[model samples]
Target: MVTLGQLTKKVEFLEKRVKQIMKMLQMVPIVAPWEWES
Candidate 1:
């Protein structure tokens, strides 16, 4: 029996984690596939 409040908390936590991961990803440089083929 999961309560709505607990579910909401879990979702909020996951959203925060996702935001952190996105920020970290942005800090890294992304190389194009064409560059690798050269």
Candidate 2:
């Protein structure tokens, strides 16, 4: 069973990963994915 502390740690890890991905994308400056899909 997942404890509250474990879940919180997972969420924080995901947030950091997302920030890193965003920074990488900004450096490349591609069109937004949603805009392309629409």
Candidate 3:
């Protein structure tokens, strides 16, 4: 059985990773919005 503490820790880790990825994405430039449609 998973304890509440374990679930909280997992959620925190995921939130941290998402924040890091968001920061990296912000540094990238958007050259095309629909380039993949072709």
Candidate 4:
């Protein structure tokens, strides 16, 4: 049985992980497919 508190904690953890991933992506120079064609 999953509790509300546990679910909230898991959501918060996932949000933090997503933010970290976004930061990492910003640091990298990722080119778009359209740019590649140009």
Best by lDDT: 4
RMSD of 1: 1.9
Residue 26, candidate 4: C-alpha displacement in angstroms: 0.2
Off by over 4 Å in 4: 34-38
Instruction: Give candidate 3 misplaced runs (Cα > 4 Å).
Output: 31-33, 36-38
lDDT of 3 by residue, 1-38 (tens): 99999999999999999999999988997558688677
Computed on alpha carbons, the lDDT of every model, listed in order, comes to 0.95, 0.94, 0.92, 0.98
**Prediction-by-prediction clash tally:** 0, 0, 0, 0
- The candidate with the higher TM-score, 3 or 4, is 4
Q: Which residue pairs show collisions in model 3?
A: none
Q: Scored by Cα lDDT, where does model 3 land? A: 0.92
lDDT of 2 at 29: 65
- Which residue ranges in model 1 land beyond 4 Å of their true spot? 32-38
State residue 6's C-alpha deviation in candidate 1, in Å: 0.2
Provide the lDDT at 14 for model 2. 100
**TM-score of candidate 4 on Cα atoms, chains taken together:** 0.80
Model 1 scores worst on lDDT over the 10 consecutive residues at 29-38
TM-score to native of every candidate shown:
0.76, 0.76, 0.77, 0.80
Strongest candidate by TM-score: 4
